[model samples]
Target chain A: MNPTVNNLAFSTTFNAAGARYRGIVLSANVGIMRDLAFNASYNIQSAAYIGIPQDILLQNTNLLDGGQITGIPLRQGTAGLSYQQRSGFAARIDTTYVGSNNSWNRNPFWFANASVSQTSGRVSVGLGVYNLVNSAAQQYGLIGAGVFVPQNYYGGGAFGGPTSAIQPGTEEYGLPFRQYWLTTKVSI
Target chain B: MYHNHGYLLSDDFASAKNDVGFGYTWLHQANTNGQFPYILCNGNTQNVFGTYPPLSLATASYFARDTWMPNDKFSAFATVWVQRSLNTISTHFDPRLSLVFRPTTNDVIRLTSGRAYSEPDPSLLTPAPPSYGSPTSVNCPSTTTGSGALVAIASEADPNLLPETANDVELAYGHRFNFSTSIQADAYQSWENQALLSGNVPISSIAQITVPQHLIAINIFSA
Candidate 1:
């Protein structure tokens, strides 16, 4: 059937027309002295919705054009330092930061990690700790779309409400808590 | 999901200044949801949901690539891909090109541009056919609502769905300060089209139900 693309109302999956993403990434590593080293990396990115799905746009009153895409961080950075000795001992520490995205304008969050290793002969052992500071970082998604109220539902029927009562369209993921691991390697 | 069968053949040719390769592949796949109830109308007990028949798809792909290093300081790589979906009567052609230059012993620059396409999930291509809840009968109680009242609910599949696609370009540079130190930077931009997502289509858009239906059908995004 040759139904208008926007008016063919059937619950189904379809393709969105347009989106754009642009970003810069930088990373570096340096050897400071005979036993010390340093490294860092930073990334900045931006995403925009150039066009909205025709059906969704028609169902909602608000427009999302030129708005930041949901679920993407705008900035991220990491820095690390390491120390090593000829005696087969090494240790390293690292920290990471992540900025908020278009959905929410909250403060940035960060976490740290540390690890140490010792190698003797053919056998070696190591210990590592992740989320060293136990930071409680969280991620959020986009707001819910406004509910569509047909003209017939104005006085009767059971379906009508403000969109504010609905939750965000996506789930929130919490960063993992602090954890530790011990590793060993043996050469045959 | 249905079973798949396919095969691939490839060959590579290498020389002092160039490396080339070619390959071909064929695949067949299918899917079904068996049977499950999707809607209940007027407090009826019997399952009124219906299901769709199994669906299958076949595809053939061919690709060729080559890397040429004309000298120690410059190189270029290119590849081309052609894919055809048999049942869908669709074909896609994708191409990529990359260039690399080493102006110094410890410094390098690279640039790349490409277009890529991803097929939709097989399950999404074969959702259960649309069905309407059973009407009021002797097996169920009837309220003041009109008789033969029905509410349509369905998980639909579109055979005409197209693959998602993206076009991207990237530039990068790297430098080494010593045997143990190095740095790199990159800039990139991309445009994506035909990204797929689940959405709702009010039944009112397709037909009108005279009776007030109390049950709201949830749109299932997963199996």
Candidate 2:
């Protein structure tokens, strides 16, 4: 029995001249009243690129072929509404959604924001709250080589048993939590 | 490290029914210095560093565009691009066309079609360092060995690869009502050829590796 599972991970650049992509976008805007407005847009696409690894030992290429490319979400969209009062006051709310791809099954997230302001003479003061929903969102998916665990590679029984899986990369959750901001602007 | 220098000249003219502009650009790019780990298989105590070969590439482009509106209801825009890359002794010609029609003050229809060329990254054009033999030293003992020797893979680089090409078309419609509500939709299709991506190919030689294709991998076995 081979006692070694020293797998090496390396990547090289090549020309995938056959990659193709297509998509559609839709957007709408409406003014509910003289001071209130809403806008939204959605995008959907199907992008295909060839980059899956082919195991030479197995002599099989179709196992991972035709899989969707990583990092590109199949569906994404955003919606927002804003209202402005003649008295120098305003409020707004927004939501965003992003679908998943081959690299990961993403969770949809939404956040809201609101602000109020008062203007006197040449000065204005405002208070705003961002990410009112405090939704935790991840920005990037894991698509690079991930860490390897010994137990996962070789089952507890023997070397030929089913091998567990390891994530090839990690995700980045860069969205900030709910926060508030205060501002004072002076006209020059 | 990379360095770039470019210059552009353009002119614009307007007529009763058309707007025309033309421009020429000249650019030179150079990749002067870089070094990276060439090969570092697991349990290999020594990592090999390879030096990058300096590269000087030149590019030139000539472009012209015209926007014509014969009447208030319809308009058209046409553009042509002629680009040359010195590294590859060839030139590319691309054309783009767009048309728009406004049936009413609140409705519009648009169509666009174009072809474009993109050059590969500068590093992709340089050849990788030659593959090295098995390392002379080992830090850890393995549990198995393969064919009484260590087998490794090396990436083969090609300097002669050409630029990728893409074609795209789009159709769009928009409508507005009461001057307060508007809806816009667009459908597009794009295809690209000569896309650049890494692939793997089996190695048939023992003491040496061939070039122009394949990826790098190192397999270490223990005893």
The TM-score measured for candidate 1 stands at 0.65
Give the TM-scores of the predictions, in the order they appear: 0.65, 0.64
Minimal lDDT window, size 10, model 1 chain A: A149-158
Candidate that would win on lDDT: 1
Looking at model 2 chain B, which ten-residue stretch has the lowest summed lDDT? Answer: B143-152
**Model 1, span B1-223: residue lDDT tens:** 4677899998999999999999998988765443454333333333434433445778899999999999999999999989886765778888999999999999999999999877877555643334443323212212211121112234456556778788999999999999889999999998888866555455455443332131123333234
TM-score of chain B of 2: 0.67
Off by over 4 Å in 2: A1-9, A50-67, A84-91, A102-105, A108-132, A137-188, B1-5, B27-59, B86-90, B123-161, B198-223
Colliding pairs, model 1: B2-B30
Q: What digit string (tens of lDDT, one per residue) describes model 2 on residues B1-223?
A: 6888999999989999999999999998887653344333332343444433456778899999999999999999999999997776669999999999999988999999999988866666656554444434322224222211122344544577788888999999999987879999999988777776654333432234343332233232321
